[model samples]
Target: MAERTYDVMILGAGASGMMCAAQLNEKSDLSVVVIEGNEKAAKKLKVSGGGKCNITNVNVSASNYLGDEQLIESIFSQFSKEDLLLWLEHRGLKPVLRKEQYYFCPKSSEEIIEILKAASAKSDYKFGEEIISLSKEEHFVLKTKKRKYKAKNVVIATGGKSFGSLGASEIGLELAASLGHESISFLPALAGFTLQKNAFWMKELSGISFEAEVTVAGKTLYEDMLLTHKGLSGPVVLSASLYWSKGEISINFLPKNNLVDLLHNNRRLLSTALPLPKRFTQAFIVHLGIKDRACVDYKNDERALLVSAFHTYHLAPAGTYGFSKAEVCKGGVKTETLNSWTLESNILENLFFAGEVVDITGELGGYNFQWAFSSGVVAAQHIIENNKV
Candidate 1:
């Protein structure tokens, strides 16, 4: 019933909204407000990188990304690992690199949250406001469950549907539709696959893990393999789910070594290079249908058959855990309607989209968070530059 006022109001206090607020300095001369529907910001952040919060990746590049390829590349080019490292340092947190693959907070994801939260110090926000509608006049009127707040500009920084249990839902996409902005249907990415055919091995080997090379179609990702009660998990399979994964994927239970060579060496000396439990190894050998022929006694065709099994193992996955277990949602705001440099909506002036709400979704690791941060920064700066704030 009463009218509240502000200069800039951002919707969704997830990674992008938080980073967007953080980027607007106290000197911006405009009042900034953030409306969040959740109890706290970045509920997903708390568990990222298994609580360590892989804050960013040192190998961030267009090649490692999916979505609107050109737009993603253009936007990310404006921010680099250096910028993020400096940003973290400014927040008094250091990002540590692990094996040229992932960068993480040395303390924990909670520490990363502390840093980003510190960055939002200058901006004001409503932590429990659930925005229901918006109307733009000379100023924008934002309707939430509790009240109506007016602002000159609004940013849809709510993330995509990933883990609904953690507040990852289709709310952003629905809001975009309400705003007259087009959004792409989203699918779960970075999730493990569950097979239609129950894998007897998975149940038998529920607690087993091994270093493995998993390939789907032709793409390959190498990492540790974990056996779950339902199916397979771990870094390699999760990443593989991004691209090669579909109805089925080919997995090399044994990688980088021919069965012939391994057998040849281990058979005569009775040494073991099969790094799994002896029982599992025996199972593997049995599944390959290789009975006790001495490794050298194998005929050429038998050697070839053994080689194929070790090199190309495959099975169809029934489905995934869907959004609740996904690390990132795959699709979002159709990239064709956005300005890469500014993240401005092509159909609507003074309305902007950022973070996972856009079609640009990144792979597992801190890449998605970094994209959220960079995109938010670009959108806020653009809004400011255009005097929309």
Candidate 2:
């Protein structure tokens, strides 16, 4: 069969690809095609936020992500969180705010996916087509197992390798590398951390969860931290995993109250005096090599030690849960290689990238999805403008 051709060819039918296609379909007359490795569109999106899908966050800024701050700032300036919310509302999909921070679909992820598909109905979708290779001459040529395709412009939105079962791979980074664009290897981000042997006592406290302040890599987060059999997993831990590559993380078990004041002249047992669960406090006390006597019985030095243990419990994580358990992956095609305003490759014209395929990785929230949408719109708008000239 003859190679199929289009004015624009988009890889991956996830958030970025679909959003880009939606913009092109709405604003331009270009013939666009979306090629997806999955059998259907937005497979991973369907499972996001436990199916509701965190579309965006109440608070979004360059500080919430790990990448070139200037690049991120540029993209968001083009399409901010307010712009995204307005767009969704105009399309009859108003996301509801959860926990007063995250914006989630009122019903399910499919609600937003359906809107995107309806908006980009003009674009043809080719599902279950895994791109095998890509090369460029007069136009870009992309080959899959069954056929070949050509396009004047190409958009890479294949995302990162986190959901392997959902067909995630390093193809996006690999393709960029083949085209002479430098990329960083993807690492598991927004995932749980397995503890070192020194923190094995935490494993015994599995299933206990509490609101605490966690500090790592110069970033401090206060959220619920869960002690799991593997080590630690929760909103705060997942966010901390984004900045932490190695070294120690400090957890303040009593973030809201001063341990010294709480223990002041208290007659209760050391474990009982703490605001945390008795079992958890007892285990920690035992791990600290401290007795569980009354708070009044501790010497000044013992009191100081207790205060430090409660306020700055430090531990080094062995590693992350890997891509299988990661909500997203950090690192990809470096932001420096792309036009920040358009997400188009500075090294190669008419080639664009968006979503997790870019080096920017946001903390666990709606930040990642916001970046995907913002970057997609930026790329699409630029493509539309380019076609005019």
**Weakest 10 consecutive residues, lDDT, candidate 1?**
267-276
Q: Give the alpha carbon lDDT tens digit for every residue of 212-250 in model 2.
A: 999999899998999999999999999999999999999
- Indicate which candidate wins on TM-score: 2
What would the C-alpha RMSD of candidate 2 be, to one decimal place? 1.1
Q: What is the model-wide C-alpha lDDT for candidate 1?
A: 0.76
TM-score of 1: 0.92
Backbone clashes in each candidate structure, one number apiece?
A: 3, 0
For model 2, name the residue pairs that clash.
Answer: none
